[model samples]
Target: PPATARPAPAPAARLAGIWQQLAAQNTEIADLTAIKNHFERVLAGRTWGDPVLLHGDLTLRNVLVQADGGVAVLDTDLALTGPAAYDLGFLDASLDFIDRWQVLSRGRLYDDAGLGLARMALRDGYDAGGAADDVALCRALRLLQRAAELGEHVQRTRPALARVLIPRLIHPYFLAAAARALGVG
Candidate 1:
């Protein structure tokens, strides 16, 4: 294991702000069974490899970009204990969300796909102790979590942006929620 990935926060608290904001607008399922199901699955999973002192809350935000096109990490909260794959996944997911956001907001001017190429390069950079599969899992987690945030954010306060964003999200959320239910990613 390496000190890169981090464990995801419990969904309830992570999504709490959103839930509060959407308490009025979101009339979907207050039953919360789906959300509960997700938590249950996440809590039941295990590492395919030995756990290491991971960089808890691992993501690109913790990785500083240097002027020379390199990175310097900050905030070693030291709570980073988990499988190395978790770090890979966390970085992938954060980068992916940022890329998708640019495209969603700025459209043609922002090349979201560049994130994919960057991810591959980063993956290659970490080949020494890399587990791309685990990284992919982390990335997917970030995507869906951030996506849920986007939904709650736009629908609550930024209705205009929500007009553009919500339509783009419907299908992705459906699949992500399904995958979460299965505990596969």
Candidate 2:
């Protein structure tokens, strides 16, 4: 049987479960909450064009380079219909997360100029029209979402002390990055 595409959650609704998990963990990320509120306020009563098919979990890990120089996307289980910006934003945030993680874990920094060029190329390649702000907001949201997911993963898999410590150490960087994406201080 062919898989059916489900409608993705609305922007505000997308982060609801993450917020619940954060609350359960007693994580107080005020900046993340601010980003969410700002996203809701800005997108309220606004239309983001018609929803389109999305690679709901698009990221570097899900892509592969073929021998013929083409690319393949794996893990289509999360495929759905949503605003096109969602996928782009998710990819952007994923790259940012990787860059930050590398710096934190290995003390190595990727080329900021190259990353900037790549981001610019990505935006130019996509016909985003007037939705630049939408992309930015979605990027911020994805950062927060990724951070919460990391915390959850740590909680489930790591030792008790790590469960308490890793999230505390890692989440602030993600929150700050999200804040920067949203133009917050």
Tens-digit per-residue lDDT, 66-100, candidate 1: 43445445787756554465566666555545454
Instruction: Tell me which residue pairs clash in candidate 2.
Output: none
For each of the candidates, the C-alpha root-mean-square deviation to the true structure, in angstroms, is 6.9, 4.6
Q: Which candidate is the best by lDDT?
A: 2
Q: lDDT tens string, model 2, 1-185? A: 12489988998787777677666666776776787687677768867766666778877566554433344568998998777788778878777664456424554444455445545554553455333447777888888787777777777887586555645676787878888988986
Report the number of backbone clashes for model 2. 0
Off by over 4 Å in 2: 1-3, 64-72, 99-133
The candidate maximizing TM-score is 2
TM-score for each candidate, following the candidate numbering:
0.46, 0.73
Residue 158, model 1: lDDT of 84
